[model samples]
Target: MDLFQPSPSAHPGPELPELLPLGPDGIVVRFGRVVSPQLSAAVLAFEQAVQENLPDGVTEVAPSLSSVLVRFDPARGRRDQVLTALRKLLGGVDWLAETLPPASRIWHVPVCFGADQAPDLKTFCQLAGLSSEQAIAQITQTPLRVLAIGFAPGQPYLGYLPPAWDIPRRAALTPQVPAGALVAALRQLVLFNHASPTGWFQIGETAFRPFQRDRTVPFALKSGDSVQFHAIGSAEYSALKNRSDGLGGARYEAGA
Candidate 1:
């Protein structure tokens, strides 16, 4: 895990708990600072290791960008043991590009870039200091790895955007972005699979819903999946939304 260390003041301290009982049934073990790729990798890798070696009593283990939530089944063991086990394992694990958990799936997502449906599209190009085409070229230039899904159900913060593309969140959030809105901010791009408010640059649209209500594996994308966006226009997005003959036309299916 030494390779995951932040330089100088960037270090996020220890992976120790800052508070106990992150909840009544679970605990959150924190690691490093917020939003750093190094720390995020550590968090995910640690979660994977714990899941593989969990003692008999753990009911659930949920991992986020910088924390892991452990839920214990009282029927099996006590929370104390769970915490101790997590600590013992995480303390000894390695988290670096060389040790990443390989992806379970690779999905191709279709997205329509810079159209009226994406109201914030123009604004995003302006903020990035690039022409509309240039912005589209950059965004679709490579596949982004899924980091973690949070904030909204099935909403993923995908990233490792080029350093020059990083930007902070807007001062205010979007009033409400549509379910398929593609939002980008800082070094991450999130697929807004459901209607919600956000401040990330609304740059694209997708036909694949990342969040669904009545199905198994509702999220179309999972952590570690790779995604590339292909551009289309407003007309297609509208057709897809209308459930008309042209549904899915606006988005390109590049394959998973």
Candidate 2:
């Protein structure tokens, strides 16, 4: 099946969304209570629609796991007018049939797994009932989609791993995982963009810096993009670390 195509055996149709006020200047269009590929696709489609045909006062449109948050100018775009326009737009479309925006890109990221870099590898193997090599193989084989970018700057939540890889977060937080740490939890993978404490299991480390403060385009990834992880040796990791391009050793191809 196409990645963006909703599974008919699973999801019947595009979910109905609720447009609720987010204070006076913002409105949130929530698709559902849970996260799924179908819901994420809907959220992306809705966000694209809003951005392409923004109402008079709409200033910003942001997509999350299952919703789109739209910010508008209250003075120029009254709440009722903005809501009405949004509703009209929503009423005219079939979200499941909409295509992802053209701006999406696919990324191939190199990771060094199961060493000093991946402190939680043993723990992850224990929980997943897999050996160290098996765990690494499983992760490297799957191509995960970027569900959303939040929780930190340019930090992407990527996934929909197979059933066997649906691992939960650690009960306790790790003091700190450095930027580019490839962590996993709740069936999703997160590429840390900043050094921060996390409850997710750190399975690998990469040189890719998704958020570069000095770059013209600060965020290297976006929602709806696909991420394929490949294992790298310590020597290659060190070589990539020395480069100054700031993308680690990763490369990109433009498409859905």
Candidate with top TM-score is 2
Q: Write the per-residue lDDT of candidate 1 for residues 1-256, one digit (tens) a residue.
A: 2322223343243434332475556777676556677776766777778778986688877777767777888778876667556656654344534245565565655577745556776777677787777777877786677777888888787876767568778999778988777887787788776788887778888776666666464555666666666666666655566643222432333333
Lowest lDDT sum, 10 consecutive residues, model 2, at 1-10
TM-score of each: 0.79, 0.85
For candidate 1, report its TM-score: 0.79
Which consecutive 10 residues in model 1 have the weakest lDDT in total?
Answer: 244-253
lDDT of 2 by residue, 1-256 (tens): 3322223454344444677778879988888878776777788888877877999988888888889999999888987788777776776467756655554677899999848789898988898888988878878887778878898889898876766667877778899998889887777888898899999899899999888889878898977788889999998998998878778889889874
lDDT of each: 0.67, 0.81
TM-score of 2: 0.85
lDDT for 82 in candidate 1 is 70
Given candidate 1, what's the lDDT at residue 101? 59
